[model samples]
Target: MWNSQSIVQQQQRLAHVLAIVQDLKALSMLPLLTNLDLIQEIQTISTATRPFIPSPTNGLSLSTELF
Candidate 1:
């Protein structure tokens, strides 16, 4: 049974981890040998943090078109 305060703290930590992962991705700083490991970590963290985030109120999908 998790309390609200603990949930908020966990969400914050997950958000921080996600930020670091995004920075690493943007800088291309990871070694080839660890790229797969990093990708797995990113997916794990994203899944963990998804519940704390709210969906868009406007009913628009988060995905965007490149074309």
Candidate 2:
């Protein structure tokens, strides 16, 4: 007996699980992750995993200006 609300709830739960899995995947790379390499890997992962957003919207961007 699946309703639309139930389907939405399940989708939300799946999204939550996916977020956890991504974090675990990153953590699992730690032992072999060097400081510089790890930073690069994390930046790549973060950019790829994040959802797309339009300009003039509330979202983060991959800033090119290095501090």
Candidate 3:
């Protein structure tokens, strides 16, 4: 349900992030990409992203019907 303008803005942000990741892989961090310290960084990012996820308790009702 995002408006077109909002979606475009988000897409631009993702593009910039992707560029940064590409730069990391191609320019400097390529050698360290697989270092053990990366695991801790990934865990930290996951922890930060966890709270924004929506839970099933919002307002949806469940149904047992299979057909």
Candidate 4:
């Protein structure tokens, strides 16, 4: 049922979410005390973004494992 344009849009969104997850992973390496708020925000963002991902098992394993 998906058209080409919608597929492209979903791919773009997946790319964006992956980038954010990467940045969050890097941020998570910092000291916990300093980055606690940021970590919480990352978790919130990760949770919010999960529904938009087309394939949870493949693309999001790292993010789910980390956060």
Give the per-residue lDDT of model 2 (tens digit) for 1-67. 9999999999999999999999999788799878778667656776675643335664434544333
Computed on alpha carbons, the lDDT of every model, listed in order, comes to: 0.65, 0.73, 0.63, 0.68
Candidate 1: what lDDT? 0.65
User: 1-67 in candidate 3: lDDT tens per residue?
Assistant: 8899999999999999999999877668646667556655555565564422323887322333334
Q: Total clashing residue pairs per candidate?
A: 0, 0, 0, 0
lDDT: worst 10-residue window of model 4: 58-67
Q: Report the number of backbone clashes for model 2.
A: 0
Clashing pairs in 3: none
Expressed as tens digits, the lDDT of each residue in 1-67 for candidate 4 is: 9999999999999999999999999878666645557656565677775533335566433144433
**TM-score of each model, in listed order:** 0.41, 0.52, 0.39, 0.45
Q: Which stretches of candidate 2 lie over 4 Å from their true place?
A: 39-67
Clash pairs, model 1 backbone: none
Find the candidate with the highest lDDT and give its number.
Answer: 2
- Give the best candidate by TM-score: 2
Tens-digit lDDT track of model 1 for 1-67: 9999999999999999999999989668656538668756665666564422324785322333233
Task: Give the candidate order by descending TM-score.
Answer: 2, 4, 1, 3
Q: Which structure is stronger by lDDT: 3 or 4?
A: 4
Give the better candidate number (1 or 3) by TM-score.
1
